[model samples]
Target: MSRPLDKAGWQAMADTLTARLETRAYIDDRFVDAAGGETFETINPATGEVLARVASCDQADAELAVAHARRAFDGGEWSRLAPTRRKRVLLRLAELMEAHRDELALLDTLDMGKPITSALGDMAGAIGAMRHQAESIDKLYGEVAPTGEEALALVLREPIGVVASIVPWNFPMMMTAWKIAPALAAGNSVILKPSEKSPLSALRLAALAQEAGLPRGVLQVLPGFGHTVGKALALSMDVDCLAFTGSTAVGKQLMQYAGQSNLKRVYLECGGKSPNLVFADCRNLAQVAHHAAEAIFHNQGEVCIAGSRLLVENSVREAFIEHLLAAAESMQPGDPLDPSSFMGAIVDATQHRRILDFIRQGQEEGGRLRAGGEALDGPGLFIQPTVFDGVTEDMTIGREEIFGPVLSVFGFDSEEQAIALANDSVYGLAAGVWSQDVDRIMRVSRRLQSGQVFVNNWAGGDQSVPFGGVKQSGNGRDKSHHSLAEYTELKSVWIALN
Candidate 1:
């Protein structure tokens, strides 16, 4: 109900957040650059303008970072530290993150083009994840095997050695914490590779980690192109494991490298074409439609588990879609730092152009553009939230992951048809069901092929919830206590005492 942010509000948001923006790269526990002293522009996506020049790491930079990590891990300065002591450092890092929340939040908005409110939410969420991991670290006890008579046996967790984690730009700081929290808790040293599109927050995170007393090399960052830095990490024998969050194509490529290279463990949370099933029932169609619109339109539909595929029962398809189209028209794009802006610019020009091409493809495939079909004329790379009605399962728009604020609508006559359409995609990251019937909710959820399901509303998640997907969406899990194992290795021992 509030009006969009005026010019003064936007300026205030920018002024508050950029005070902590240091135009240096955080590398190997220091805010410095490669030996060649190269730097790259960190752009403000809201305007397609440069915000600052950041350190650009290359292959040599990666080698230095890995060597530093190897020494830190071998010396056991951090890995060998007592769990309680490690907890203190992690807790302190969380505190630091909280203190610098506003700055980091603004940095993400400036660099990634997400709204400032969403950026701040990411900071708060990252700090919460760290605190949760710190609490969980000490609670986890190595197993005591139930031994036969006259036998002693024990099992314990060990750090998985050096990890090279690649994160996407959509949720920079939050995913970084998702990787580092459990990895550090289990005593593994880490080397991070943040997307070149949004590397500022990750660099700031490195500085904060060091200030919190994390040993040098224990947490280092590499910010470079995926073709170079990403492939290096994937193929490095020195790197023990790789955790990545990005497109399914990239995940497959990394898996191939993992298989070819040291057979290092690979964990990924890849793309999704999640389904939002709306069944005809005695409920509020308007409310359900609003929730569905928000699911796919939030963050300009950059979320991996975005409910972009909408399957509505034939009986309610017309009414539901009417409400959906109305909602989509209201999601306007503007400056990210605007306090009242619901929609922000796309992350970069390339992605913006890609989404536009997809929109053209939808029209060619006979899908009707009900609302929001094109990019507006603007200075920043901004795409209005798009919708394609009468979409078929075989259309390219339905099959491919657009990673934008685009939705595909499908009408189904039965529950079986809806489920079939939902499961047809190669992805299975998340799904949502909207029905007032408890029986319908229980039935559809049990058969839905997704890691997370929302019954009546799209549930905003929390740290305690285990989230990840089946199939090409990725392997392993994040968030809950189970994620701890992904960053750890277990060892079993047996001794006979007479």
Candidate 2:
């Protein structure tokens, strides 16, 4: 349901949002400064208005945060706390987040230009995931290895030391929770560095964490450019592990930084140009068209797992295009604060230009522009939900990760041809297949080189499943029990009890 444009309700919500933004960065369980009170202006992507001046934390601030985290981890006040105590704190944090859901959702929409409805959904997902991680702690048990008559061996899962989480601007609150909740639940101290474009929610989450009775330095939020603070966290010798979600280029650089300083564990969930494959056997053209539209245009098409490439069978090409165009019209960009908006503004002017540049490059490379192509004439950085048909596997848009609301459609004749075209990209993050034939689904699902594949849907799964990529998309998963392995070190303790 669209949030009613109730003037009084909106005005009150806006006032509450402004109050939340009064303080920017949260460090060591307190709202503080960046060495000299230096701050950067945060823009409201929905309206191109200045929201607030946030602390522009740099290497110095990162160093201070790392120091505090190291102390907290070494002191055992938090890191060595009983699992039940830690779980209680995390569960409490989840409760606090739910209580302030409206404030957090508004903060996300104002800071990152996501539709209010989408932001609320993301907030709810974050809360549920955090609660799940908290609940899983007591149930987790280590193993006992079978040894011969010589010795008794016990396998233990131990928390890695301080964890530095670097997250991107898109889905700020939820991504932050994806990294922090697991690390905290695993008993590791964490330092979070959120994107400069959307730091408000992360800062607010830090306050909530403290309110939940988490020890000082257990969780700290730093807001700044990636080069200074993010680099500092990556290179810090005291940091035991680094979890990041962003571009493949930055993820690679962080790996280098890890190697250069200390061989700390680095887990990255990077870019994607996911392919959505449709076969002629799928008779539901209308449903397919709708899912295809939502796969790309959702969140202004600013998702890592966005189905940016659409590969359809040649038999259904013309009919699919017609329905797809009809579906695209419903996803035009609108005011992000309005819950009715299905598509919101691009994260910022810089990203908007990048998307447009990619569109022009797609045209230059001979891809046919089917639907929306240009940015809308409006106040915010809103682009039309674009679709390019007759796309070949060789086109620039077909191979590269646009990370926008642009979908490139290609037609293939046979099952093998479709698999070949879908697997042609350098990325193998995600892919989706639509068909009723069990044989085709099994064959394609096996041969398709990707971390995750959807049978009837595109880009969906619960927190129970692992999420990550292969090849240039980067390594390691984010959700599920698999992610806990990234934050903990397995140890084998042996005893000569014989």
Candidate 3:
């Protein structure tokens, strides 16, 4: 399918795909139902309609999937394959994803209510991650350690047998690809548990993997809730490693589950209330405001690294807010199927209500609502792009991770104060500083306790950069070659030359 030129063309494509959406879980290279025959309806947040009745996998399904993954890994059909052979298979999977880009984009937009345009844009990141990891497979090399004259030491990186990846709903295909591509590229059997809110893309991708020559049981997708299928996978004794991208609370829970089971290795990329700082010395306040609005409102602010907290220099705070309001006007919520829409509905009613509640709390705490503060009328779980000025560091809306299109503005007089405010939150995922002063940028970027810091920009990075968080946000990295470390184990072999 080609790229749709307009809203109608995209809508027509979406209608066609919705009529025949895949709902079955993919296991052992085939689509199947839950062993208990239980099912759950996945709702389209855009229209408040049921898109499909997906298999609601539970402990039994988790156990079955793990057994298959274990067998596949132990059987060496995939885990023992040559790196070049595995690379070819992964590259083929990437090609299939590119061929089916439109279908996969529609599945995510319909399931999670992101704008079709945004959903389509996500495909580049998803496919690029796969291709990058695939190309890196054979290129990765084991290292030799400096040793005494009579001894030779070798340090090797090997796949951790069975990996369970739990991805969130916000960026379904992209997050799934980020977690699984490297794990699969490392020659580990992966069992993916996508958030039940949006599982269509993951299921579809699993089928594509099989068609791309992935061995049976090498890759599986289970569509279900975190407490059941997610918990089961984290606690499975046969599962050697677990990788997750979601809320900080759930990330912590999975860590506990890992400890209770076989002490499996767990890697987490969790939540953030990331801050964006704007100094009076910024080269362009108008440009900074435009990017700042995008920093918080893009994808309905569902981004874990969304710059929800905006700390501006006190001298230019008022002017920046005015420019920010104008930028926010262009991001009003609309139909996800429409290519012209900039913002889409929240993932579900629960998330919609949570965002609204946070807005109300901001008001009650004496924070002034500078722009939108109410949910838009009509169907779907839509909330207008909201901004709250006069937000204090201690305010509820300023400190917590709302994970919505809500921006809390704060004023600081000094660079030290800006750094202090940005690092005050429990999260340290990502941060941004908009200033032309090189010294100030250097000073603030070093002081801010975030995993990634952008100077004179909002959110701009590619697959080559390592991404993750520090403090409570989460541990471990995703993307770049650093990610492969999460899915692999290190072993040392020493040989005596005597």
Best by TM-score: 3
lDDT string, candidate 2, 75-137, tens digits: 999888888989999999999999988888888888888988898899988998898788877
TM-score for each model: 0.96, 0.97, 0.99
Sorted on TM-score, best first, the list reads: 3, 2, 1
The segments of candidate 2 whose C-alpha lies over 4 angstroms from its true place after superposition are 1-8, 20-22
RMSD of 1: 2.4
Q: Give the poorly placed runs of model 3, Cα more than 4 Å off.
A: 1-3
Candidates 2 and 3, the one with greater TM-score:
3
Over all chains combined, what TM-score does candidate 3 have? 0.99
Question: How many pairs of residues collide in each model?
Answer: 0, 0, 0
Per-residue C-alpha lDDT of model 3 across residues 1-498, encoded as one tens digit per residue? 444458788778777888887889898888999988989999999899999899999999999999999999999999999999999999999999999998998899999999988998899999999999999888888999999899999999899999999999999999999999999999999999999999999989988998999999999999999989999999999999999999999999998999999999988899999999999989778888999999999999999999999999999999999999999998899999888899999999999999999999999999999899899888889999999999997899999999999999999998788888998988999999998888888988999999999888777888889899999889889999999767888999999999
lDDT of 1 by residue, 142-166 (tens): 9889988888898988889999889
Candidate 3, position 139, lDDT:
86
